[model samples]
Target: MSHPIIRVAIADDHPVIRMGIEAAIDEIPTLSCIGAVGDSSALVALLEQSACDVVVTDYAMPGGAFGDGLQLLDHLRTHFPDLRLIVMTGLDQPAMIQALHASGIDHILSKADDTSHVPAAIAAAWANRRYLSPSITQLLPARGAPRAIAALSPREHEVLVLFVSGLSVNEIATRLDRRKQTISTQKTAGMAKLGIDKDADLFKFASELGLRTARPDTE
Candidate 1:
């Protein structure tokens, strides 16, 4: 039996990137490029009007009804619960990678990496598996390294989990029924315990410790 076609969409600010990805999608037998848009607003509008199985988007795209980065991802996740996302970006920062993972994006391809992996990434996302480009994987803490979560107090761990799961400090405080300052303190303490001084490192640590919102079935 023939496999069902996977309707895919592309969103990137650069026309070259969008067209390149569209061309790649055309080469895959089971994948179809249903829409290619320049901004998140256009992408959202297309999604609302059409059916799409997967979305390959640039993380840093700006000027949309919803702006880019985590804001765009959050909006998409909230509005389209079942849509599979594949992020294609030049950002290979440890913290950003961790944040993407925390936000439940399973397939991430660095723009610097081989485009040949794009098809694989899309397939993996559809299968509920994760595909991280080599550039991103190289930034992860070495496996078997001591996990920072072990050093955290229970409250600190709780706060870190919520924060990495894409909650703002104020939101976390509201959910935990604690003062925002208290939540901030706990977050700081947890990061310190983990030797993490940057926001990205906190996300990296949480991701390494499996503290994100959704765990991938496969790496």
Candidate 2:
């Protein structure tokens, strides 16, 4: 007799996407967007402070002093184990999706995905079901994900991911805040460790690393 009550949170540095999500949730019958954050630190605070059943967040947040979506995912998984997650990113790769899959991300949506699919993705995550944007399903290359992931050292792994995301050695340097040469060496070492040969291979490797699946482990 009563519709389900789903309190939701959204995080993204982008205005259009955040506005779109807020608008959509406002129109939905049983859902509410309670907290919307522009930066990762704000997101963490919102999570700790708000009451919500699911949190939908952008995969990459620019101007986010803490832009690593994976890190937020990990923190949520660690501190709010019962909270559900929907991960949306413009970067859809086999490795990234697979990593999110392993980390128990309930839904994976692409920004280019149909807007109608957003509500459905939220519903699936609320139900503890999984959904992925069709484009993500089709385009994510699964071939190298597992092998490449197994080969990465933790730091090299982090460097490899930032590198492949088109972050320059300097940007990566700035994000990681290391010296330019240090970032260069890390890139070189990560490349050697992963045997990344070309841009194509670089993408394949990023996919498996599950940069989206950065959930913290309790055990």
Candidate 3:
């Protein structure tokens, strides 16, 4: 039996990566390239204007109105709950990959893997199954992810979430209506609890735990 054509959209900050994904889609007889855009805003606009079955989006496409990383992914998941999403990310960190799964993203393709994996990810996502590329798969077990995140106090959880969501300590303080020193201390304490020393590792850890939606009391 012949399969129905799957309409696909590509969203990546790099023009070359977008072109590569489009090219891959063109080679698949059952897949059609609907639209390709550079950032989150354009992707959102494209989805609004057109219908597609699957989206292959970059993990870190900064400079868009919706921001990037977990923030962009959360927006897409929230607004397009029924849409099949295939995330393409160069961040091979185990925590981040686990976080993507925690956020209900079942398809993740490593950019380091060939663009050929794009079609496979699309197929899996369309069928409501999980698919992770070779590199991303190897990065797992992602052990202790849950316990580490659960160790944080509510306030520390709130601070870490805001920090990884791209807010500085000062910005998070203003947003939460707290003193900057308090925010900084919470961030530091959270990192210590998570056993994360560097800011980069903290981003990975926080992302893995799906903390973007955490709402602790601000008062």
Q: Model 2: number of clashes?
A: 4
| Candidate number with greatest TM-score | 3
Candidate 3 lDDT tens digits, 13-115: 8999999999989999999988999998999999989888898999888878998777887888899887888889887555566666666677888989998
Ranking by TM-score: 3, 1, 2
How well is each residue in 17-112 modelled by candidate 2, as lDDT tens digits? 898888888878899888788878888788778888988888767565555556667777888888888888876444455565666665888888
Which pairs of residues clash in candidate 2, taking residues 3 or more apart in a chain or in different chains? 74-215, 95-207, 95-208, 96-207
lDDT of 1 by residue, 1-219 (tens): 999899999999999988889888888999999899999999999999999999999988989989887778888889998899999987655544655665567688999887788888999988998788888677545552233455667788778787888899999888778899999998898777665678875664454455663422211
Candidate 1 or 2, higher lDDT?
A: 1
Q: Model 1 off-target regions past 4 Å?
A: 142-219
Please report, in order, the local distance difference test score of every candidate based on alpha carbons. 0.79, 0.71, 0.81
TM-score of 3: 0.71
- Candidate 2: misplaced stretches above 4 Å? 62-67, 140-219
Model 3: residue 205 alpha-carbon error in angstroms: 6.6
Residue 37, model 3, lDDT: 92
* TM-score, predicted candidate 2 vs. hidden true structure: 0.66
